[model samples]
Target: METVTRRRTVFDLFVIDADDTLWESALYFERAEEDFILLTRSLGFDSPSVRRLVHSRDIERLALTGYGARPYLGTLRAVLDELCPRRPSWADSAFAEISRALLEHPVILLPGARQSLEWLRERDLPMIVYTMGEQDHQLSKFSRSGLSDLVEECVVVERKTPEALADLLSSKGVEPSRSLVIGNSPRSDVNPALKVGASAILCSRERLWQAEKEDILDPGRVHHLETLSDLPSLLSFLEAAPDSASRDL
Candidate 1:
């Protein structure tokens, strides 16, 4: 809804998500998709067919194996094979350009992310960053964003599941209720935290490829926000509420 900009003096720990929530990660992948389209077109392939084939292959691979760089790169290769049959003569150059573009893509931090982290840090709240993806890519984004130093810990988790979140909180001796998870995905971020008895702030940003909406844990226990700018007031409101205080205890 609407959030009044106010400072929150409570909250022991804040766990934030990287990728689309914190930075412009999806944009890079989107650019890669565009480059893929051009590459396929130049190779005498139909764009829609190539996309459909790759999408199907990716879904199948993700279901059977898992989602990661290997499977993703494999999906691209599969699409290339389907389009040009055993890698065309121009494949090498096209692939290199696409890869370079993806690599050189900048990580654009969302408005209010750094400010919010700094504010919480100033208030002595322990803020941690957690994301799921290839470790190298995720960490590289963090380094580019320059917010890595603001976080006490930067965790690149394999899977963003409820059990994983619970384990992390338990291992750190942080009660679930005392922890807050802020992220963009309902499936990966919000529901998992809510399932683990932690309050979640779901920043409602339009993601380019949300291939995991099929499974979302308890969707009710989430506070939806238009942007992270609303976070401060939401935290303040929650802290002022007696119910939230009891849950934290």
Candidate 2:
């Protein structure tokens, strides 16, 4: 069966999120996992045993703490402690190295991100970012990322919700109906955008956690896309939006 894709045409502003949405951030955790594996191997543990322990620990941490830098650091510490109690010296050094690396590492922007932002800049379309995190960490990333100058404004909110987005939009003179929110998480980005009458674009990432699948499948108001390059076409789609005429008129 052929499916009809809905077209958007009224959007005037683009509000994007950083972290996993714009760049390659989560791979730090993956590298930490490799460190865990090496530690387990040194302790004479097999791959299966190491995998089971790490997976179990990760699940526990997520359930208790959700996702954040501190929780991730704690999780890594726990894994190291479990695998190398006798070699506490090694664990200390490895953990320190991983933590330092994560703190300094900037996320590698996805392909076409820079070019797409440049295109939007050339068009004079107001671009902004809405993100949730510690002020220093988030702000520092933006300053170091080189994408900071491209955006007209940046909002670091305490939380990500419909009310929060609406508040930000109202303060900035951006109408929800004319704003487009682009990000990687459907739960955090799409649902909230829809609730506030803002449109959304969901850019699929390479490593979306399994728990996030439901949101992606049932995103309330979003255009699912494979890459950032699709953004130009999406903007065109919005520019060519269908006219709505009322029967009374």
Candidate 3:
């Protein structure tokens, strides 16, 4: 763990990110992409080249379609159409399988996600699972995560921007200084929190999505943790010594 400046404050609300932060999200998407690559390979396309195009298209389509399994499948379909205009009937079946696997993937929580949330709940810390993407799709995952009972609410937005974070804090009556944003994405989670004056905890993961890659805007205001399990200890330390000078952990 890494800490920056010390501040005498206790977080009133915890804004947690859903998807990759809490459960297995990007791993399923990666599997779908591998399936797409295999399909293209069977159709005589270069595997490396197909993978590159899929990644490029995926990032490019974010502005126009936003994030979600359906939109992601659309990107793959577009890539397939471009690669093989005369695709085989089997290709359709393959896509259907891929879609089913991606859309209906199980909500497997990350190690310590449940325990950490339970710890926070025991302390009466209010938490909200804040996520972005298609509302129905995101909400569906939230409902299945088994974390619904722990958090006070679940918020889904088309995109997570600085303005969106600000509005959410304002509506919740949470001061930015007294709020903590916890998530895995620098682009969507950490940066937005910094922009809105909220402290952020970056739960770094091994398999991060390309679209979520970005530099941390303000490193000093952010805490980097290896996993959710470490969160409780960090917060407990802060609560115990609010005025202690920050040091590397």
TM-score of each: 0.87, 0.78, 0.93
| Model 2 error, position 54 (Å) | 4.5
Sequence-dependent TM-score of model 2: 0.78
TM-score of model 3 (CA atoms):
0.93
Model 1 off-target regions past 4 Å?
1-9, 63-65, 68-70, 214-217, 243-249
Q: Please, what's the RMSD in Å of model 2?
A: 6.1
Find the 10 residues in a row with the least total lDDT in model 3.
240-249
Best by lDDT: 3
How many clashing residue pairs, candidate 1?
0
Q: Which lDDT tens digits does candidate 1 get at residues 160-227?
A: 98998998898889988878898888778888887888877788777646575544455556668887
lDDT of 3 by residue, 33-100 (tens): 99999999999999999999998998899899988899999999999999999988998899899999
Better of 1 and 2 by TM-score: 1
Q: What are the lDDT figures for the candidates, one per model?
A: 0.76, 0.71, 0.89
Better of 2 and 3 by lDDT: 3
Q: Which parts of model 2 are misplaced by more than 4 Å?
A: 1-9, 44-66, 82-86, 217-220, 244-249
Q: Report the CA-based lDDT of candidate 2 relative to the real structure.
A: 0.71
- For 1-249, candidate 2 gives per-residue lDDT tens digits of 555366433456788987777776667667766776776676677877777777778778776765555566777678767676677476567668877777677668887787778878888878887777556667777777789778856778755778989998898898888788888877677778877877778887877644444444334346788888878776666566444310000
What count of clashes does model 3 give?
A: 0
